[model samples]
Target: MTNILTRPGLKPARPFFSSGPCAKPPGWSADKLAVDSLGRSHRSKIGKQRLNYCIDLMRDALSLPDTHRIGIVPGSDTGAYEMAMWTMLGARPVTALAWESFGEGWVTDAVKQLRIDPVVMRADYGRLPDLGAVDWSHDVLFTWNGTTSGVRVPNGDWIAPDRAGLSFADATSAVFAYDLPWDRIDVATFSWQKVLGGEGAHGVLILGPRAVERLESYTPAWPLPKVFRLVSKGKLAEGVFLGETINTPSMLAVEDAIWSLEWARSLGQGGLIARSDANAAALDRIVEQRDWLGHLAPDPASRSRTSVCLTVAGADEALIKRMAALLEAEGAAYDIAGYRDAPPGLRIWCGATVDTGDIEALGPWLDWAYAQAKHAN
Candidate 1:
């Protein structure tokens, strides 16, 4: 840490780094949006095509398998995940693992709301639960990335190859930013808002063959809400997975999602993941040089390349809040505050839309902000 106190003069060109509703893609503007779909029914001939376009492009960007089903669903990622739990779980003994806030919420849903006596496993904020200890004979549910903690499962090597149970992943923050072992997961859910920088209130659900089989073959005992029901009268509602959404959708938001997918496709070879990885690397260089700041995730491999969370030594949640406020007031940063439920620190989004150059600019500003906070003390 440098003792000399001169604030960095250069500010990040685009300072919007909120973890959710992340920054828009390069060259993005309201004008690039598909205005034609506005005022049109989402199920209309044109509207359906727009929706299908989003599905198509999303699959292409993710390089999903041919057998997997990708569908648009209501209530964002939360809706899709709840639907999976309501419809597919309870058919088998369940294992629920939570490392942070969102993951913990799902575990609560499984045990409390759904009233399923799941085998619960948990880890404190900066660590991962013992994946090897989970019994695969029981259906399992977890988040691939702990968004609030900025810790992600390193890989899918821990999953048993011949496991009998289904694996449901809440991948809202992991899909585009990290490599997901698709074959290992039976069902996965994500919102358009996270890595892709699209509009919210809509979610993308991906189901593998096993997941579909579970929906088709098993009948859960609990009655499901209309919004969470994926099966009707002993069968999966095929139309919902075919772009005929269960409810009316925002065509404008649909268009925005489509455009973002197209932009990802335009990146050609490495696409969004490449850009995101580069941004994380840039920020990492900044963190390595400072002894005062370090990753919240103890292990380097577990650190998220998307949500770059940092913990400053001797800083309490209150002190971190003051520093975040100082950064926001300076116009050099915005929405980079840590998750409210998380230990106090800072979280910067390094998704594809965020320029590595902006991350580089943020380095000196972080230093300046820390200095100011220290001086205040």
Candidate 2:
């Protein structure tokens, strides 16, 4: 039990720790939108330039090779991934790796919606699927970071570079915060709402040379939604990759994405990654010492630096919920509850946009909230 009076006096200056729609850049506000060319048509000269800027900024910041094509798509990361899956998957035997909810959702899409005969490799929440046994000759689909389960592939070492298959990775929560191997990933998808701390409704799709070749050569068995069609008349759509969106997009969100990218540039990729690493280290100090709480991912190497999920030892779901609710009511944290389908505990966002000071501040609040919940119960 913790004494209420002894509860740490410090609180996070920013308490916006939701896994999605994460915290804004260090100094972000609507005032930063002054430069946005709002009220203009998306296809207008200014609007198109703004959209293209978002693409270029991310490409340069994330250090994608010149061989990769970047595009802004609708419906966030889901739409972008579905587009790639619909366009390129059936051309080869597919393997869908599942360790968390989103990865499982992809498995469902392949098996049920696409009706493709997919080899599904699944694992328990905190564990990663076996990387060594995967057939690299088949198209491989997986999430680089398991946001819901707290497990993440440490690197791209598991991927075979010379394989016949294309790797499609859903890196929505992993990008920007972690160093992703763009060379190994043929098709990658991420939403602005994740690590970048931008508004949603749009997703960034990165297509490597191999992924583009598939788009140009292979056609889907089913009709692609207008938004999901990446190719037309046997050629990659030139306009789509150059900011001619499938539908109207929010200019404000586009500006926000641009702003976030600029922030990343100012800090540099290494600096941005360091911020997340520091936050994770801050969390580890408290969690490692506490026997009551442990990381959901038992393997420290597989633990995600971005979405640091945890499990409380000997605590039931109700107690976990109560602790989260109490923390929220007292304004110590927000959206810190574990993903609904995951083991009940907490899912703290330790991405680059989050200040390490804030994460350090969070440690005591969790302790205070835990004691309060246990005593009240």
Overall local distance difference test of candidate 2: 0.89
lDDT of 1 by residue, 1-377 (tens): 43437768788999888898989888889998878879888878888888887888888888888888998989999999998899899888999999899989998898889998899999988899998899999999988988899999889988777889999999988988877788898999999899999989998889999998999899888887877767777777877877889888888888888888888889842777899999999989998989988899979888888988898877887788778888899888898878999988899999998998999999888888888887887
Estimate, for each residue in 209-262, the C-alpha lDDT of model 2 and write its tens digit: 998888888888898888888888999987888889988999989998899899
RMSD in Å for all candidates: 1.4, 1.1
Looking at model 1, the pairs that clash are none
Per-model tally of clashing residue pairs? 0, 0
* Candidate number with greatest lDDT: 2
* Backbone clashes, candidate 1: 0
Model 1 root-mean-square deviation: 1.4
